[model samples]
Target: MPAPSFMGIYPADSVQEVHSSLPLDPLGPGAADLLAGDVEFRLHYLLQEAKKFMVHGKRTTLMPEDIEHAMEALNIEPVIVPPRPLPQAPFLAVPVPSGTSGAQQQLYTVVDDEIDFATYLKEPLPPALANSAGVKWKAHWLAVEGVQPAIPENPAPSSRAGPSRLPAPTTGAASLRPSAKQHLTTELQLYFSRLTAALIPTLAQLPNLPGNSTPSAPQYSFPDAERHRLAALASVRSDAAVAGILAYLVRWVAESINKTLMGATGTIGCLVDVVEAILDNDVLFVEPYLHQFLGPLLSILLTVPLGPHPPPSGMTPTTIELRTRAADVLAKLVTLYANGYPGLVPRLLSTFKKALTSSPFPSPLGSDYPPAGRYEGAVLGIGACGAHAVREAIWGTNGDGLRSINDLIGLLYPGEGRRNKAPLVRATMRALQQLTTPKPEGATVPPPDSAEVAEVFGPHFVRAFEKRPWQAQELMRLRKGSNGDAAAVQADAAGEEDEEMEEVQA
Candidate 1:
């Protein structure tokens, strides 16, 4: 498939059939007209497919076939588009010569400044974002700025109260403002609480799928519950809901890490605990009710700092705890990702880096898998955040570092003098396994060929999976365990064998 000379722009749905090219062309002429003419047809197809992208600023990549399909959809022939290889923009796009002239630096800075200024000026955020509970999660920051925090007050503030006596306006309102810690707490609390309620329908739908079926194979059920979780998370701005969600995620991580079977029961328990904690309360999660709340809590911690913005100062303690808890949490998340949640590793790495190097948090202990005791916990959480970017080559968001992670996992496991923290390693491995395997009951399994997969798993994924012949074999075994009919047949075979033995005895 030939790459388009220019970036393409089509009505988002126009690119539904696009697999390997830029979905929308920005540099081409008459792009808007092209979109307008084919808008209805493209929209019709998109709606039929229930395609969801773009709402997240996702650029749709297309392939030759996708471009052809899109052109055909519009009753136009696919153009024999020639590849005009424009210099691919560098990730950081530094100038070739270091210490360029002041004029050059100013020119570069002006461009950046203009882009930021325009983005800042764009008002009234996407409705999906604005309507999300995330607004409440970080609303506490509003308190820091001395603004009336945005939140759904438990008693619901009365509209009849006229504006209170006003103070003179501050210039800070003109710029990007930092939110207060207390307000962040209140907002996050309210947001997750609401998310818990919203996920009920999806949660109710999980028990319906045959528990033992490969997601790719024909299945009697779909993961409505998992879908709800993803959708609920998606509905939020990545940053806004992160803090609140992290609060719950850590608990899930802690529980699963400590579990025995390290399978559905433990994983599901963690998920349930997380969902319930967010839904059921407005307070600190501590035991009986707390019983291994750390997993979900840690998950939240690892994610929030890596979210759209940095955590508020108040949430620094939470961030610190996660950093203390990170070596283990990170190892577990990586394993979980390897097992099935491979897509999540990239996200986790991003968060982990943020928590390690960012403004507020301290660095992690030198080694991975810090000690599990309380005092060790105190120093474990330091300096884990800062904007240390992973080398894009080593770990592209597309699951590139699996082999490295696999090595790391080995180091974390029992023996190797790291056995004292074996539980963390075990739980981390279980999480990885769960992530790599097909999601269990009610888990939403994304389409292997979907854009989401492509972004995380890379374009040539099936081939990549085939490359790891041994891992592929294990995946096959896991698939059988997850298959309903196969298990039934195995059960029947065992029963028949038992009966024949009985007959021989008689």
Candidate 2:
């Protein structure tokens, strides 16, 4: 069939035909129109791509195989073609009743080959394998020094497909071998295909074939793709047999996160979910690749503005939600690996502190100031790393960082006191509360005088806990006996050590 003009916009009816062919309910006209637009765009893209393959092949005329090559390169499922073309069946014309009385019309239809059921039944019955319960089994060494021995339990080598026939990770047919590509099995390739089709589908659904996004984006998460995504996440979470592709999955998550963090793409809420799934999967051996996730997670948490330009109304909703979600995953990951990997908590705590307190060279607020959204994320990250981080990281030696934080909060909520001013102030106070003893919800612990609260935890805490005396009292009781300025110097010494250690490790 000739390809449609890439610029031509399709109507809902065209998209409906695709649904009808697949046994799915016809899409709503609105959705169909949107899909039609996307389909037209892909068709245009596919034609341009096919021309490249045609040029490379030095052919002026496009071949069926050239189109197939373009589809495969775009991650589309290429249509398999037979090596030898079959002869076409001749069309038969039969007389059919026309508009009126004696007039007749001829209708053309293919005369398909018919079979005799009686003869087919009498000829033979195909053999069937026994059920699992009925089958006999025996165990043997399938391979000794990487060679499978042919036996009653094993298939003959001649009948089995080998590594040379299997698709390589790259385009390396010659370089791929059983020994060299031990883990790159057919199963792994299938797993990758399905997983990519589920999570990042835009490319897979190219030319409007079965597929999302550049793997299909629901403006293309077609119902089936959404289900596939959930099932894939569940498999990664609970399946114990996927070690061969664990590294690949890790890189996939990091890459998705980078694309969004670097502003090259949009929110990867699914990748955040993937990270959480992997972190929750206790069965997986993830320690080796644990560091791979940190860079991307931190980038999401601390990258300023999160996009090319800040919205006039301030941080966008998507940006806020992503930062919040990334912070939670970072916390779970850091807490999980903290004990085995010493200095993990403190290192992250230091990093968050720098973002929270230090402004870069071209700061609008000043060199001492940082972006408000990033600072808020820093507080959330520090809280996630560990609650104890507030003492050494936030309070600082003699409360220097806390002083800067208090000034920022005061500037944000000018003339405000006696209540939580904003989410940032709330987050900072909550981190401080972590260092205090827990008070029951019903218990009424009288707060310290405003002067004393400011003296102990700095003025920011005073602003944060002004009305909530329970939180204020907790900080007062815990910090009363501690030497304030002197112990801060000691904590500063420890904070410096964490900084130096993180630098060395990096």
Candidate 3:
């Protein structure tokens, strides 16, 4: 079929149809063709002018307002109809069919209005009517002094309140002024650029090692002069404003890591350092921003394929180390805000359980066995949350937790031992040990005995081993020897402490 044409040209057939419709006062010669062509040209001109209005409004599409504005600009009067009730149809009840079901047997009401045939047969349209309130131009400001005021033209408030606490207002007359946020945003952008530049260099190789690693003395020193300057500026700022700035920075860093494959390690490292500096600065406030920080921090911790474009072979050591640092930041956040935010621990644990179990690659021996850096981060994050969280995660509602733990064990130490994800397995073990370890204050419940552990895990133990035949012995050792070994290790540590004390006295 040929494509339809609508380039403003009226067809001859349409002109003939229009001429035929009007018979009482028929057009002579080529009058119908001339009228149709004129009408089409006028419509096309109106549309073109409307598009110009749209362009002035910084829009690509023409709207009803643009058409109205165009008509006014062109000095064209629009036909306005007076407010009148629309013609109503007479209601009639129709009988239901006998064969219909009981539910469908009810009478149906139908509107059957009588048509005015004469109105359709009219030779020409009635004279263009003008209503009592005829179209007239009214002027209003779309924006005033760089701010769209809450006037009739712009009634809705520009700033919306988010779920988090509202940011504290700045001092002076600026608080009452409009566009104050624009100024703050400009200032924050400047600060963020400076901070990003300063921090990016420190990211590749931080003066202080991340995680548990610590040098006897400072391996390297932070550029205190620069850091102190930034911290001082941040300290004097309002808590809410500083929080907003940090939140934006966090989002930027996360986007850079997820969207860009190159420089992911440096980006992640820079993020970790920024967070550390914020936490370490006693002068700077963080409470108001804690809620905002949770999501970006969690995203950084658990984003699958932390770097989409890894080394040609696999993940580089830098990528792995970057992920480890990210996980540590997650743990720190949990510790800092777990008490204030009751839901933090549960959510973190849930993320861990999901990451550990949900994998696209089924076989551990396959090239894709390691999963993503985020999955490993989840494991480390869980361990950092504390033992109670680990217990709840592994022993979810109604023994679901026990099943999840068994699944991880099977995946990590399959019987065949084709490939062992050492880092993942070690993280899981650390979480388990943390879960089972006794607390000094007895705040948490003591670890369950061997009998309980066996009973809870026994049902799936055989099936898990069956999938990986080589890991049966390792599973057995985990089940039988974990408690005894933990006890012995504690005893040995105590013995060494006693010898140290004796040497000190001598």
Task: Specify the highest-TM-score model's number.
Answer: 2
Error of 1 at 291 (Å): 24
Q: What does candidate 1's lDDT look like per residue over 386-483, in tens digits? A: 11223231232333433343343344332545335433333223322332434446544332433433344333333434433343444444444546
lDDT of 1 at 168: 19
Worst 10 residues of 2 by lDDT: 166-175
**lDDT: worst 10-residue window of model 3:** 168-177
Model 2 RMSD in Å is 26.2
Q: Which stretches of candidate 3 lie over 4 Å from their true place?
A: 1-181, 185-190, 202-251, 257-263, 312-320, 359-375, 395-420, 436-506
RMSD values for the candidates in order, in angstroms, are: 25.3, 26.2, 26.1
lDDT of each: 0.37, 0.65, 0.55
Clash count of each predicted structure: 73, 18, 7
lDDT of 2: 0.65
**Tens digit of per-residue lDDT, candidate 3, span 295-344:** 66666666655543434443233555665676677677777778976656
**Which scores greater on TM-score, model 1 or model 2?**
2
Cα misplacement distance, residue 467 of candidate 3 (Å) = 25
- The global Cα lDDT (0 to 1) of model 1 is 0.37
Indicate the residue-level lDDT of 153 in model 3: 58
TM-score of each: 0.20, 0.50, 0.41
